[model samples]
Target: MNNQDDIILRTDNLTKRYGGVHALEEANFTLKKGEHVAIVGDNGAGKSTFVRQITGVEQPTSGDIFFEGKRVEFNSPLEAREAGIESVFQDLALCNDLDVPSNLFLGREELLFKFGPFSILDEKKMMRKAKEVLERTAIKIPNLSNHVGDMSGGQRQCVAISRSASFASKLIIMDEPTAALGVQETTQVENIIRGLKDQGVPLILISHNLRQVFNLVDKIWVFRRGRIVGEVIASETDGNEIVSMITGMQGGVHEKASYI
Candidate 1:
């Protein structure tokens, strides 16, 4: 945990439930601006649910969410995005039939006057911006004209990450970012993540890869079932200790670790 001044996003007594089934049990979390935090948990834990609530995919049953310095409620993902919260879900939400530029600018496209009363998509402008975003992120792909269907898993993931990072001004939520990537591809994606970190993008990465989490994040938040159980600064703890906490061996150790 870092100092309170560094925290940019936080949830107080956040909770969610599905038809009387409590999916999240008053879980709390805090993220500092420009800080990289990893959320690690098992299958049944509320990591996904917690993320869903924060991103406006689902609403919390009871809680308070604060972004920047204002407390607010988001009714939809777009609302969350408008508030500078971007999420890269495990599905990666890329249209396979579309080209790199098309996928990058999906839903939000550039348009210019064509006929007297009608406008057409400005493909050239969108492609230029897409290329610029890719270059800025140091991402390499086959070509901007290449169809996403023809791309490898890692390439598609990079596009997804880049799309989120492009609009993300404060926070980026990544769920299982490297779940299906190969060795080389994982390295590439990891480098892209580091690049975002270098630019001071705050991230909440949900992963099962202990090595990746320990190596990249400034802090780790461990979740068990539906509650946040522990949080440890990456520099102050080892993977083994985190593993023990995740498996129920340790008890509320991180309660003392929350500085912000």
Candidate 2:
């Protein structure tokens, strides 16, 4: 059982709808501090929708979101970030033409000097901070001055993950973080995640890779047909059991399942 005081994020009866179709339904979920959890299911199973609502990419049709013991209604992703919730979507949202430091700072650039109506961007400061952030996350990018467009898929993914980790004070949400990477690159990203875990940072990972999910997270939340079918402790359950839960083959175990 998880202590209520340790809960960093909680959703009560969370639901989302579009016209006549329900994208998500009545989800009661809790994530504790420093805990890593995975959300997995087949396509159209509401995994992305649930994440969108939580990250403020979209509003819930009904229900409440509680973060760090306070009820929150995030009007935008910026608001969510201000509340210490950062997300790295599969799209990456980085400017390919920009350099590493620029991409890391993106919309939140720093200003160092001002003259009249003109202000100079703090490029050096941004680069220094970017290096610090990468080092802290144990992310290795051989060339920090190269354009992201020229980088490999895994490198780009690492930049996105690093950006999220740089400012995230509470939780980081990653959607298909390693879906497009090679084996070596995937290992690098996974190592970065492990570094986050070592630092006691909480994370929520959404992925179709059952192996990665089982290896990286402590708990698994199975979603099926817009609803969470089960929550299983990773150490206590196998991939087959999780697959069974996702397909609805196993019933009546969700309520009684023990989760950390």
Candidate 3:
């Protein structure tokens, strides 16, 4: 079992290179259990690249990843999820034709029975579980049977978040989760994030919206030119200071607190 004070995820000298291009270079980062962290950067700041390496969408050119006090190497996204790390990307990764329950149990559908060579989906069980999960997260979808394609952007985003939260046992990573959402929808998503914090679920959020970052996360990790330029406690800093750090206008004061 992981202690509350344990480092849930840590990257040491993490780097990724494509030929001569250095997408991410020597990033040392840590996320503690139940801590909410935000990754912010301008375009091409290697934010997505960092997420890709950790999520097993791509291999790091060099470095080590430690999770829950154990070193791990995830060869695919499935491996990451199996290790109790769930990510909800901007795309949401839902089947437009499927309903909420189907999307929630997409790849790992519950099996009702197996006959010879066929196994059937336990959809009723999945639907019940889905409703429970949404309730736990304080998320309300008026119709769980509605197809994803018919739902509004915010509803779709909530479905993706609900799926991740339902299955995630260790950490949850969200990439621009509210970028396409309207004000009301964004508020709804923020409430879900707050609910996660109250539940003591560690989260890593990647976003460019400074207001949301300041409101939702405890710490901010700024990336610039393929490198992590700074890590600031949200309570001690503001958007201007973070923006300066991102633009390399000022040197970041490295906090003396132990990171990993």
Best by lDDT: 2
| RMSD, every candidate, angstroms | 4.9, 4.4, 5.2
TM-score of 1: 0.90
Error of 2 at 192 (Å): 0.6
Tens digits of per-residue lDDT for model 2 on 1-260?
86889999999999999988898999999999999999998889999999999999999999999999999999999899889999999898899999999998876778888664477799999989888987766656787899999998988998999999888568999999998899999998999899889889999999999889989999999999999999889999987788777777765446435422
Deviation (Å) of 130 in candidate 1:
0.8
| Cα lDDT, all candidates | 0.86, 0.89, 0.89
Against the true structure, candidate 3 reaches a TM-score of 0.91
Q: Model 3 misses residue 106 by how many Å?
A: 0.9
> Worst 10-residue stretch by lDDT in candidate 2?
251-260
Superposition error at 166 for model 2 (Å): 1.5
Each prediction's TM-score versus the true structure? 0.90, 0.91, 0.91
Candidate 3, residue 234: how far the Cα is off, in Å: 0.9
Better of 1 and 3 by TM-score: 3
